[model samples]
Target chain A: MSIQIIKQGMADSIQDNGRYGYQHLGINPNGVMDPIAATAANLLVGNDLNDAVLEMHFPASVILFKQQSLIAICGADLLAMINDVFVPVNTPIIIEKNCVLHFKKPLSGARTYLAVKGGFDLQPWLGSYSTNTKAVAGGFEGRNLKKHDEIRFRAAVQKYDAVLNGKDCEILQWKASVKNFYAAGNILRITTGSEYDWLNEDAKKLLLSSSFTISNQSDRMGYRMKGDNLAIENKQQLISTAVTKGTLQLLPDGQFIILMADHQTTGGYPKIAHVISADIPTLAQLNAGEKIQFNIIGQQEAEGILFDQQQQLQQLQNACSFPLLKFKQQYAIN
Target chain B: MKSPLPYHILPLGDHALTIELGNSIDASVNQNCIAVFHQLKQAGLAFVKDIIPAYASVTVVYDVTAIRKEKPSAYLFMKEKLEILLAGMDLDQPVSHRKIEIPVCYDLSLGIDLQEMSQEKNMSIEEIIQMHTNKSYRVFMIGFLPGFAYMGSVDEKIITARRIQPRTNVAAGSVGIAGEQTGIYPLDSPGGWNIIGQTPLKLFDAKRENPVLLEAGDMVSFTAIDINEFHIIKGSI
Candidate 1:
């Protein structure tokens, strides 16, 4: 069965973990901006961690389900409604056939992920379903979802029915909480980069103490920040080098830019710092005009936080899968 | 053969590592960077996901989940493994090279910044075209966009800085030069380089087995052509 798009909102595309092994050719690893939420949604639907999901930005789309399916909506509280009835986030639910799903007013985060059972039956480009819009490749026709675009699912009626328990709409009891991954006061933890020594002492002080406002010019490529100017000790040009997602670059004008999922493979600006992996999801959810402070942490500390986050995700995966295994054992007819 | 060059391995967060070869952008240093990239890929490390080679460094991105499963720490495992690999590394080893000829049409209508560049350099348009086509430049890196190969060390006379006001849209296959580097735009995007000509060939086709026309460590030379020839080549493709 398939879902038909009635109205496409701001920007929505199919994404998985990310596209890899092509960075040397200048290809960006475009993928879901928030991995934790996306993975949580996938786990709720009994799909693999890297299974493709619909990453919808605020003011997202309206879809009509052609057949009954099990689904989960994670991340941003977009006020999702199924046939005029409100639904909750971070939980699995079943949608009856011919029911319309739409989003209302903007709520908390900037992105929301919708995962279906068995994942989407979309073709994978470069070994990934993640869309790279810049290259006009990958995902569904290499672009944002447009009105009337139909997406087919790898439907498993028996599996979804067992999860649904023959109900038209059912919400699971257990929900995956993303609160532990986010930092208090919107402070992002970062580690000094290779060129961190280039900044003067005063500049370093300003960077840590001052709060930076995210400019409207920010996008999936980078988040342009406005704050006190950071001065470098030397005026020499940095030889262009390899850069990756989360690299905080200092522009010529003394402004800051945090590279995001769709960032270029290499850059010429001096990388002053890099945000830790654990807090990347929080940063991804932050909207423009939001203020963020940087907290400098040692590399070892950053690694420790990342390890803990991964371990928590593994525990959640195990928790979600156990119930599904029991449901399958009871429902399957020999 | 020259002795092995000194390098510093720096961490680029928990999952990636940057190998800085040197401060300058020399051909030899870039070759060494490429050599290390090949060696690392040949190692077939289960943790390593991608390797990017630039002007003077190679950034290796790894899967932390996979690495952490085998070792207590992913970063430490990468550092130790790389140290052992580099201990026996030979920087002077001979490697194969590929030379590619790109056909360009330098018609004044197609070259938006040709006249400005000519005036700034105090050279005639024909002379500028001749200088651009004479040298076989080396590909230092491929970045900024997909299939955009950064070829370098353009003739000193023709070298010019980027435009103060970048154009809103630079068409795909447009050849441009900025500072000591020359490159062709694989996609239409905002750019500030001095556009001198356009190529009919598709520099990047995602449908192809190899999407990029050029890669790091390759040699590229331009062949000037007339508008009619450009149209002929464009139609044939």
Candidate 2:
């Protein structure tokens, strides 16, 4: 009925699209850093795009399914394994009861999302299942997944005798195409921030030309970038204002921070540039110390990329529905 | 109904747009921002996910997928709609406000920076406390942390700049001042404001009907209380 965590990873928590409509109350929208992978994972499992999924990082969690279930692992290629056998990501897998799941090594991205058949049975706080660690009030008891934590599935366990064939696990043939979304090759697209003109000519030139390394201090809240000092032409105070994810704020010391899923609702720093929303998934996948370059694009182009991504996701969902429904009905799975 | 102050809408990212009313924290400018926020919220546009009001701007976080379903370009669609809405809004007109009175204990133990502030301002501790409690502060924004309220224009006599080095952790309910602004930390977080008092009432409670205690455009007045009253109020809440 539930999946027990044999071992816990760093900051493993449940996340969805995000907690929204509460920024006015100073509540930050804490959600999955990489929406593409999270959505694809949910789509693969025949779950709603907003269904809660387990977000795990390197040294990922080791889990043992207490019951047979259909699940899909997406995003970071952490070398997923079940019962000592290798498994592929971006595809659904039916696992037998008591089969152990773990990651062997970090292969590609920084975060991996695992989605179950009918989503988690846990209750949502404030209209969302995403974990708000600061408030400690949402997602799986409002905290990171601990060792031995058993999260129940929303759907009842169904016997996958036909698919498993007495085997430990079986992988499906279909997989979501996720490569093109991260095809920017470490270059994240950006749009002009409101305070973009605040930067001096040299700083503005350096922003688009030079590369910045994601500092070790980077996390879900914000990614601190280390690069050439970017200074504003006029050294004056900026009033606190609303900031969203991908907001590249120039700190007082020339270095800047790119706010992420857990960013503060409002900030006072100067926003030099904003990473286009379409590239947030790609930016979220970059590991600490990875060098990332920025390319500024028009607002329309950025929105076009975002619209295309959403359309692709919708197409994937549409393609998987019939097959998933047939398979679920065959096995009496919810 | 029209906005007297000049305002412009800029795309924050592909998914969000910000309406900049002014550069500084003028009350009229913020009022205009709030006016726009209220109108948008009232419209209940399905594409708009959240509307956040800050000191002098309002940020509208929209759903690109939702917007694209109705229009070819999200930015253009949103910009035109927002422009039309703003054109008909009378930002000069005053909006109703909620006044909230908060009790604060100015004891030194709870206020770690009181002694330092007293020395820096060359004023008696009582005078500093008097200045803080004397005037009603306007909450220009709610941010930095959940339920944290940024209120402003403290008495010039007690106005202090942020500390050279911010403390690693400031306890919840600790009231602090930074330059012309004063705020209370609703959660335990690192901050740079100069602490002067503590409040027992929980600024934020997940179980409460309204989790956030204060919001932008709120009028907050602090009433000084003894240490015992602080405990009694704390225990009661």
Candidate 3:
């Protein structure tokens, strides 16, 4: 069974958990910018959270279903319409064959993810299907989806019974999309980076006190901003060194680069601070001109919070295992 | 040499620590990085993920949750281990030399910035090539690009600054000089280095078990080759 693309979005590509362990080779592990939402959508459809899915940017839609299918629309609210009926986010819906699935546009966030049972059948590239627009590798032909690109599907043990049973229209129970839980604008706490000491006292204060808006310059690689131009006390060339995802780099030109999912393996810029790992998902959802404040935090406190967040993910994994764990339990009961 | 004041093993992120051996950047700091690297790995610090040796500073990645559970002062644990390791290490470690023949074609058509680099260095194009190839260099680090080794301590005479304008794309294995340091591009990437020659060998290949030809702290020397020899090596690879 397969789904065909009718209306290609502004930018759409397949992405999974991302490729790792190759940073020493200078390769940036590019993947879904909003991993949390992507995983949520996959879980709703009872698919592996790391399974490949179509990541669509603002403004797009597609047609799906060969022998009926179950899918979930996630990430941005995006005013998604299912067969002329506007549907809510964070829920599973059974789609019929030849249904004209339309995602009118993203109103709140930048990108959205669509997950199907058994996952989209996109062949992996270099062990990942993530789209790295800069390196021009990975994803579909290592680029964005074009007009009328035909996407297929993989067969699996559990074809959503709701779809296989040939239900005309069925929507799953509702749970609020995670976005609804957060305050519109909250202070982002970050651990002071090694370069924090290098920043002039005035610049350091500005970093703490000032509000910065996510500029249109934001992309998968880095997020640019217009704010109180943070400065460094010492303006010497820093020899290139290894950096990682979430490294908040301050450029010599008095700008900040919030490293994202597709950030380079290493960098020479003096890193100002790192956005706490738990907040990275929220940071990814931010769209152009979304204003947010930065608050300095202690490393120990942040690590404690991060551990709690990890434990929560482990719980999520345990919870999602109903897709397979259900069968094991039934067999034991029999 | 005087023992380091003491390194503050502070957490960097969820999985890393910035062990500050000295506040100032110096050769001693780099040596300390090398020393800590040896000690941490020798101790079979499985929780210690990776160590990135920087200019005067080294950041070691580890599971913060694990470290916190252990409640070991990163300073006490690391410093204690380093003191023992440094005490045993000899400053005059035997340095091995390898004559790695890189087939480089010094043609301007392929090198792109050959003429512009020579003009900046205030030397004949031929003179620049000779000075660059004649010097043996120490591999300081492997970064910037895969298999791209940062070899340095070049002869001061040909120490030209990096181009103010970075080229959008420098082909893989391009030999370029940035200031006193020379490096090879293992992958096609944008760079600010002044390109003087192009190497024909494949510096990186994912298929190989050890994809990189050079690593940090290795010794390297490049030998010039004719365009015909370059094509032969290039095609054979």
Which candidate tops DockQ?
Answer: 2
Q: What is the TM-score of each candidate's chain B when compared with the real chain B? A: 0.97, 0.96, 0.82
RMSD for each of the candidates? 1.8, 1.6, 4.3
Q: Model 3 - which docking category?
A: acceptable
Clashing pairs in 1: none
- Predicted complex 3: DockQ: 0.32
lDDT of 3 at B39: 54
Candidate 3 residue A312 Cα shift, in angstroms, is 3.1
Which DockQ value does candidate 2 get? Answer: 0.85
For model 1, residues A1-334, the per-residue Cα lDDT tens digits are 7888899978899999899999999998989999999999999878899999999987899999888777899988999998878889988777888888889977888899999888888888889999989888888899999899998987655334655565556675667776787778889999999888999999999989999999999988999999999999978988888888899999988998999989999999989999998889999899999999999998777877888888999999898877766655765711
Give, for candidate 1 chain A, the lowest lDDT window spanning 10 residues: A157-166
Q: Model 1 TM-score?
A: 0.97
Which pairs clash inside model 3? none
Ranking by TM-score: 2, 1, 3
Q: Tens digit of lDDT per residue, candidate 3, span B1-237?
A: 544345566555445666666654344555555555555556665455556665455566555555555564433454455457556654445334454656688888677777876776688888888887886776655566556777776678777789888988888878888877888888788998878888888787754666677755556777888888888888988
What is each predicted model's overall lDDT from 0 to 1?
0.88, 0.90, 0.70
